[model samples]
Target chain A: MSERILSVLVEDKPGVLARVALTISRRGFNINSLSVGPTNIEGRSKMTIVTELESVEQVKKQLNKLVNVIKIVELDPDNTIESEVLLMKVSINKETQTSVIEKANLSGAKSVDVGQDYAVFELTGTSKELIKFEKLLKPYGIIEMIRGGRIAIQTKL
Target chain B: MTKEKLSGAELIVRTLEHLNVSTVFGVPGGAILPAYDPLYDSPIRHILARHEQGAGHMAEGYAQATGDVGVVIATSGPGATNLITSLNNALMDSTPLLAITGQVASDFIGNDAFQEAYTVGLTISATKHNYLITNAEEIPQVLLEAKHIATTGRPGPVLVDIPKDILNEKANWTEPKLEDLPGYKPTLEANPKMIQQAVELIKNAKKPILYVGGGIIHSKANKELFELSTKYNIPVVTTLMGRGAFPDGNELCIGMPGMHGNYTATTSIQKSDLLIALGVRFDDRVTANPKFFAQKAKVIHADIDPAEIGKVREPEVPIVGDAKSVINGLIEKLGDSEIDTNSWLNEIKDMKENYPLNYNQEEKGPLKVPYVLEELQKMSEEDSIVVSGVGQHQMWISLHWKFKSPNTWLNSGGLGTMGYALPAAIGAKAAFPDKQILALDGDGCFQMTCQELITASTENIPLKIVVFNNGNHGMVRQWQKIFYNHRFSASELTHHTPDYVALAEAMGATGLRMVEKSDVKRVFEEMFKTNDRPVLVDCVVDPDDMVFPMVKAGGSNDEVILNEDDLKNI
Candidate 1:
């Protein structure tokens, strides 16, 4: 029930991601969302993951024990910036287009692409704002929606 | 050094030789044949085990018997899978072992072509770390790294899986690099402030027990541990894996404390106010239920592995370092001083005298395992090595045998693998060729790996095998009888069980079966006189007999049932 965010650094190698994911799954926890990208250092990558933890400390301890994992830092909300990007194609037409556009504009949504009958609106904001924007667009009948899971950064100051 | 053109297989053997591996135990298969081709030319002795599983255990036995890391080799598919149990066994006990398994050709790896399997994936969880060689040239560095990892920092098993074609690929021989790894450094020095805190706690503790473990043996911290115990006038109780770490014959040696432990040891842990747990993992058998285990005791755990710290019961004082280094630090900090806890010592002495590890010596029944093992212990050499398989008989041997030195007692403490002793005895005998060796196994357990008697006889390993023949899996039967309303299941070995004596004889070993308690001493004495060849003693014991001072599953260690009357109330 406790969603914890973790930043994991590991040596870049084939199946290294599988290993990290495997370790979590074997311990009976599924990743809510995971993103992997190269870190500042060569031959190393950073993993941003969100998972429901029964005991965050226990999971951290286990993760720390994994041979591939170089380091694991659990982000503290007070010092962290958490956000997400979402793209939704709402079922819109001439009748509700203006109101939908006005609502989208108010909610900080930008029209990225448009087709004859559907429009793709991109919204980048904190997860709370993004979720609220999606909810507001749901009444207009969302055809398809995709979310880029939360990415976080801990501030030094 | 100039690079010599060689195949990856040749380089693997050369790397092992360069690392000074004296022996490799394994069975052959198609995928590993490339490595085996060059192995014959290598100086390392190859122990051709009957089964890959037996080979794995033999390597473990060699590692445990000697301080050196043991090497195991096997092919892919079934061969690699066979080593899983032994890998887990070594991992749990923290024995240093390196297992090299072959994989199918790279293209055929996932296709399941000719003995292909997920070798690395299968054993990753069981090993400290594992490698699947993607590049043929990196084999030496990986093996060297594997060796370094296997033998260092709370030693455990490590596996390296190499594809078959990669072994045939041309590779240049190069000297192995020796340097510090970037991230995988283990803390070897105890924090000075933490050492001071532990010293303070030790001084304050009135009723203290030194809970020693197998890590003492691995770290060679026995002398320091003894110094710590004797100086502070603390009693010592060893776990099953820790049994031989401390001298069992010492007056301060309370005995093993856990499931099937002696009454004095288990009760002492319960009553003590302080438990100085050295290199012990606080296994479930020792604690039974952590919530109720040593409720009044403040624990001080010192180990090289941080993961082991608080993995079970949280230690009030946690010292992360090599056990020897930590003990040395403690000895330096604490100084040579004996605390005045005469009242505590007297209370322990009373407890020891009140609850003796008793069995009916004069009972009119078949041979009893306790009496036989006790007799064996007395008859065996003072420096003999005793290995055991899992079962009720394993409990009996552990309870009865008195080890005078370190590395003299061996058992499958963690994984509890049945049929571990025969091959392990063979390997240990190989390690200490001049010493007397014995494998105490039960009928059910002995049957599991008794085929290794062939290796013992052929290799001229004069290991004396003792079978506690209770006509069933005694531990399982006991569990069923006690907890399951005597619901007899598949535990009975009465069906399809071959005569152990005849089986041993068929394998070129001198076999004898003793049925009466009167013959126990005479048989042990006469048989143990000369271990010129392998000997099997089938001691038919009372099937109804049960191990005492057993902590029920999930039960409090303090609430151990010592007798049938104690069980009846529960």
Candidate 2:
């Protein structure tokens, strides 16, 4: 079963998340990545849930049973432009500055320096791009990598 | 009518009335004097308990019986701390209870306040939710939210810590809307595919056993469980917490299976081809040796709590949803599967016939605990509610009594609270006034909260209490006798006990004492004859009498002592 992302909109309230998470969990769905944030609309929250589903029909049926869910949309990565933010601190010294800066610029990343020891870079792109960027920067002595687990949004109308 | 400026006490009385709370059980203190003043004039009746713990238990009993959130109030500091045990009791038992407590004052908070603690933080894990109201304006919403959280979703206790200053502050607050909580949600439906998979497994398996737990009662899925078990012809085994979910006398019943489970039930679980675990957590006590337990079967665990699944033993098909909804779905998908377990059923029957829950004292001992439980079982209706205090009496009641309905047996299952019986009985009686509510209490446990007889009388709730007066905590003493070389440390409770009959009379309730073994039956008969007030039956039983068919704690279920011979043989 390949992984699928489920974006659900629900009434923002106490116990609503517990209800939704419990429902999905009770259904035996192994949720991979879950991000909950307030939506653009007031008193509403959007929960982006990524889980491995045995079948699409099963996901739909399970999602339909949940109460207080205003809408649920299944996103397709093949056609939709999906992006996730990646934050990392790479050790930048005289020995590996060239390769690290080249990789960061290639990945459309901006470097923010705090001290002399290391430089923190913020990168936002597809999961594939982030992976590629991480591999390129590995030779430059990467200190820490924190990937804010995937949050997706459709690009086209 | 003159609308005078009301004190914090007045607002409390009015708020309680607005919430339609008819009774509040508590012990007043210096910190709560302000609130107590208005309680005198309020329509809500107040039941003063001997201890703060009793008050908390009374509230728990009320909630469990009525299916409404039970309300308990206490003073600051020690008063609030005393409620911890009962709060933990409610948490473990999944009883919906609302405990309101007074704090020292807002100004005094965090300054090593005399009677102030971070009650909200202290009770965070114990309570389903908690609030510390510093502002009087937030009182109405805090109360509303407390109730909503207490009674909703795997019901548990919720605490509202009111600062003394806030209670004293006057505010014109209307009933606030129960705002939507952002973080809390409870699931009510099962995944259809998992339900189908579970159904398919159930349909295909020849030797299927249904292991139900307390969640069935919590979710009110007893009817659904019964129907599914009956339709599929599956034998049922229950956890200690799951007692009373199915009629004990039912042919398909395999009895309670756990650390202290009967040999037949445990063996059946071991040999079954498919174990259908419904609403059970499969606690270590229930599945001592998980690898050996249900080893021959494909496990299907259905529970409302998501975290419970695979926490102990992994299931082949895990159904996470409300027990009622999932069971209903399973019933729907169970199409024309004439699954038969006749051979398996006969095996269980033979085991039961060979090794029954029996205590050999045919010669008539001074006290017969089993005989008392048997009489209570016979006299009460199938739906009559039974609550028990922790100890040998609890296990004895579990083994000997035949419960025909779910939620009828209320005890401190997970927590095993000793003083649980009297207060829980008070709560149960308050919840179901028309139903016969009985508390199978031990002498040690009964004395802990026996003072609630006053509350029982004052509230006019007819609660029946059967004290297995064995003069000790029978369970604790039994351990000392069996494993501790009979050293008899603090186990011997030889303190002066009150003249229970006289005590009951003092509390304005009826009490009967059975000194002679032959008079036990007559006393029970006479006790049941009265309906005007509550009754307490003080039957002096033998302290040496142990709840046999005992599996040593942390021992495998198969290693149970059925009789004295079994103990000697082992």
Candidate 3:
């Protein structure tokens, strides 16, 4: 199975999201990540879903059957701009502070919250860059971390 | 447009009248009493069902018979929850049905009020579309939309949940306008490129089978289907839902193909070179072990629902459109092109003659269900409607009855709900009061919803029902005998509780019992003679009789067991 992303536009109505999620899960497709937000239109919302599936054609056809769904388009990974945000809190001390600071600076991470022996950093980048940055901070002892799901828009409409 | 002040309940009745709904099936309760008040003065005929499930199935039966949107209503909590099975049945079969239910007052919702349930949440998956109407003003448009969504596109069930407060609230109503929905346009025209490609395949196919399904009847395309089949000389094999879509006696017709399908129809599909599948989903019952079904054949699949096009087995050419339009496109594209397949036709003819559906009746024993169906088939007119409950009796009717027109055969094919026949027969009789509507039910199936016989009698529907009483869930018993080494395991129902004839009499209908083989024809003749009131005939059949020409579930279609002799071989 390969990773697939779909951008769906649906009416902003009660239980619409439940309907979409139920339709997908009941069809036996495991969703890796999903993010929903309002669009420019007042009564319409956009959903970006990431899934690992054998084929996306069947999923598209099934989703199209929903009466609330306005349109669905697939985003090509090669032709799309994708990013995610990560919030992480790491423990540090005198010995490790220098190395952690150096790694954070190198990766353009911003220090958001600071404590006596711990520091919280916010990072934003492509999924590949975030993975590498995350690896660099693993030695510093991560206390907490939250990774936002991927959101994408086609570069060429 | 002049605005008329009306309550939400009155708006609903007016909207249904505007949609030309003359009859409805339902039950009344506290939450829905407001709507019933308006219904009391309306010209629409309402049949009070014994149960909410009965009402829902009756609507499904009406829709299946007339190709019209069937409407049903019920109250909150238990009444609404009871409609779940019927909604799922209509969803599975893609029947056009509308279910309206009353919810607790808007303020009382989510408080776990008495007789209140999350009707919309429970029915979301079972309906093609659904709405929870909390505002009184939303009634007119929402009802119109619900009917449109239920009747158009793929034709499935839709539900509308109206809060009690909304029904009682007054709203200013004007002539309603159907709002345009961007997401809900159904593709009615087939792609020309796909049609041309299908025609090319059809012209070259040596052994082609028209795999037809219920979409033909839903789209009213039987005439086009018949013309295409006879003109191209292609053999037609109908699925369970497609029983009456093609004339059974036609030379090109091979009969129903599925687990309990005819030997010729099932095998011909296995050996065909090309499948011109129209309005059919290759269901598991029909295409057991899809990997081995029609392995060498190229399928040209057409359906109104895009999701069904490549759902089971991938097709060479996929055309998403209504069946009638798709068939018309194919006919136009293949203008007078003749296909030569004399060898394949001869092979099919041989199979048909050698393996006709057969059952033996002992010189002195219980009546066979097939013999009973044959007698009914002979005694009934071509236009008579036959509805069946799910079991051995249903299979016997599908296998034996010679259906000559569309909408004459109705059954719960996908859901296999046992209690479907009696109530559905009531619905069909309501739709066509003058037509001969027969309900062929099994002993176990009859017991499930037999109480609906009172609804038929009270409404004076004049439906003729036959219960094939083998005293067991015959299909389950057949499976146990074949696969489980005859461990009966609670399938028996013959020990007798309430006698069927007595129950029929208590329900205010005429009752008759047929036990001897010689009484089958005469009993059916007598049943048909009584046209003024509902009649129920209890036919005591042999418990050991089984439905054959069967492909073991999920088995290859090529491995069909034609009879008990074949079973012995297995």
Candidate 4:
């Protein structure tokens, strides 16, 4: 099975999100990551859900049956601009401090939080760049890591 | 804008009146007492069922009989929980149903008060859509929207849970307005390209069959289906739910296909090259072990529910639209084009003659289930509504009865809920007072919800109920004898069985117990002549009688037992 990004448009009803989640979980399909926000249209919201499915058509058929779901369109991975924000707190020493700051500067990431024995780095980029940033920060000792999963819209032709 | 105030229960009645709902099958209890008060003043007829399960099945029967959205109501706790079986039944069979239940007052909800239960939370998974209305104002919008959801698209059961206090509270009422539902629009037309592909597939296949189901009745597409089947010269096979979909006496009809299905229908699908599945869900019973069902066939599935299209087996061409609409499209595309299926028809005819569904009444002794159904079919009118309870009797009627019209046969095919026949027959009789409605029931099945006979007798619904008394749970006993090595544990209901005649008489219904086969006709004539009240006939059938042509559970359709001797040959 391959991971497919499905962008769903749903009505803004109370417990509509729970309804969608229940439908997915009950059908035994795993949701890797998901982000929801109100769209330009009133009384409706856009949800970008990332899930690995055996058949995209089957999932589309099921989600479309829900009363709150308006439409589901599978966004092409190649024709979309997607990014995630990474928050990582790492332990460092005087020797590692210079290397960490230089790595952050080189990677275009910024230090968001600071403590005596830990410093948090915030990075925003494609999932590929975040993987590299994770590798560089691993040597210093990572205590915590959080990534806001991808939210996307199709780029204009 | 009139701001006239009304109680929650009043709003519910008004909304139902506005929606043109004429009848509701329900039982009143303490929690739902306030709602009943308003119901007494409304124009809608509220049928007082003996039990909540009876109410649910009656609603199902009403929906199946009239092709309208059926309604049922109950109180909290046990009352609401009793509806689960029929709700699941409706969900699986795609019946349009609405169940209203009373919850404990808002303050006593989680404290487990008397008759208190979390009706909404517990039934979320069992319904197509549900609502928990705590405020009185949400009643109108919730009721109307629930009706829309219940009747539109792939119809199923939806529940509305309202608190007792909410029913007591007063709320301002403007004209009923449905706030726009932005996300629930369904696709009504099929893609032309997909229809063309299906036509091409049907045209090229040498061996083709139309596997039809109950959705044909739901969409009222039997006329179109018959034309398409005749025009293409394809044989038709229906599921248990689809018993009345096609004319059973027609030349192209190959009878039912699945577990306990006819020999020709099952084997035809196995050997055919093309399966034009129309409005069928391909339920596991129809497709024995879905992994290998019709493995060689290139399927063309046309159904209203997209979720049902590829849920079990992927169709080569999926036309997602109403059954009548899709078949009309097919007829438009392939008009009067005859394909040479003579060889295939000949093979099916040979199979039908070789393994005909046969059971000798004299060899079996006192009475046979098939013989009883044959007599019932012969005596009843062509348009009579035959509602069967679950078990071997259900299969007997589904196999033997010749239903010439849609919605003439009503049974719980999915949930296999016993005690469905009697109450469902009551609902059918209520819907069609002019037409005859009969309940083909088993001894074990009749006892489950036979208390509803009081409702029928009181309400003047003269339903003819024939109970096949086999002295045990025939189906479970058959399985135990075959699969469990003759361990008849709890399967026999002879020792503590009630006197069915006495029971019926106590309930104000006519009771006729026939043990002799010679008295069948006279008893049926006398029973039918008594038009003022309902009649119950308890026919003494052979306890050892088994429904043959059986496909054992988890077994392939090819490995079917044709008869008693065939069982030994296998």
Q: Taking the tens digit of each residue's C-alpha lDDT, what string does model 3 give over B69-89? A: 999999999989999999999
Chain B TM-score, all predictions listed: 0.97, 0.93, 0.99, 0.97
TM-score of chain B of 3: 0.99
Off by more than 4 A, model 3: A92-98
Per-residue CA lDDT of model 1 for B485-554, tens digit only, reads: 9997988887226887788789988888788877887778767775778999888888889999788989
User: Can you write out model 1's per-residue Cα lDDT over A23-119, one digit (the tens) per residue?
Assistant: 7777766677788888789999888888776555666766776667788898876788877889999888988888888899888899887676788
Answer with 2 or 3, whichever has the higher lDDT.
3
lDDT of 4 by residue, A85-138 (tens): 999889877778878878886998998877667788899997779989999888
Candidate 2 wrong stretches, greater than 4 Å: A1-157, B1-19, B381-383, B495-499, B502-511, B531-533
For candidate 4, report its TM-score. 0.92
Give each model's whole-structure lDDT.
0.86, 0.79, 0.91, 0.86
User: What range of 10 consecutive residues in model 4 chain B has the weakest lDDT sum?
Assistant: B494-503
Interface RMSD, candidates in the order listed: 1.9, 9.0, 0.6, 1.4
Candidate 1: list runs displaced more than 4 Å: A1-4, A28-33, A51-54, A93-102, A116-119, A141-146, B336-338
| Chain B TM for prediction 2 | 0.93
Q: For candidate 2, give the lDDT of residue B449.
A: 78
For model 3, what fraction of the real interface contacts is kept?
Answer: 0.63
Candidate 4 regions with alpha-carbon error over 4 angstroms: A37-41, A85-113, A116-149, B1-3, B106-114, B172-180, B568-570
